[model samples]
Target: MKQVVENIESKPSTPILGHVSPSDVECMEEIAGENWNEDCAVYAFHSESLFIIPKQRNIKLSLATLKSEIYTISPIRVFDQNIRFAPLGLLRWSSRSRGLHHGTHRMHNKNQRKRLWPIWVLLEH
Candidate 1:
């Protein structure tokens, strides 16, 4: 089912949503075929695409394809999860394959009860 919103309703201009809502899907379709802008960027966390909605029907975008770039944690590419400042460094993460904070979110003391000491050292130190 396709629902269209002729005029956007009240919502966060920049919502750090966990998923791409149904409206976002419709918006994506519209942007894809009808009125996509380049300067306006869409943060589709659910769909895992960073849309660059500029001012036309065809905007720059990053949709999940087989060849989509995968940002990963390697010994060289990203900082180690055990580094001294790893906790402070985890302010915001951007990825295409996973939703925001899918894997690296902060846990509560209950969850932390099961972790090893070194892991806590990284998070608390």
Candidate 2:
């Protein structure tokens, strides 16, 4: 993981154009000659082989989340304009375990249960 981060940081930063479009994804699928799958496409995008512009806002949030180690990728919403290109994920167990304070003991207790929130990665359609 450290090596991966170092590699990314060492590379010259390129301005990410924008989120992948549906047509672009279709083109990639066509170019892949029928071997394409959602998993492979996703990996390609993350690996930078697919070349969609990174959403700058999401990038910042993603970096912060990575450093905090508090979230996990959930899913990509294909057609939703509000959340198309986003790092959709769930909060980590440890993060969720941090309970709210300044309330009753039962409410503030670390042992108090919490549910994982669904994170949406908004992208352009």
Superposed by TM-score, candidate 1 places the C-alpha of residue 104 at a distance from the truth, in angstroms, of: 20
TM-scores, each model vs. reference: 0.18, 0.18
Per-residue lDDT over 18-93 for candidate 2, one digit per residue giving the tens place of the 0 to 100 score: 3333333434344333322232212122332222332221322223222322222223324333423323223442
For residues 24-106, what per-residue lDDT tens digits would candidate 1 score against the true structure?
33343443333222233344344454443323334234443332332221111113444322111233344333322222433
What are the per-model C-alpha RMSD values against the true structure? 18.1, 15.8
lDDT of each: 0.31, 0.30
Residue 14 local lDDT, model 1: 45
Candidate achieving the largest lDDT: 1
* lDDT for residue 20 in candidate 2, whole number 0-100: 32
Q: CA lDDT of 41 in candidate 2?
A: 13
Worst 10 residues of 2 by lDDT: 98-107
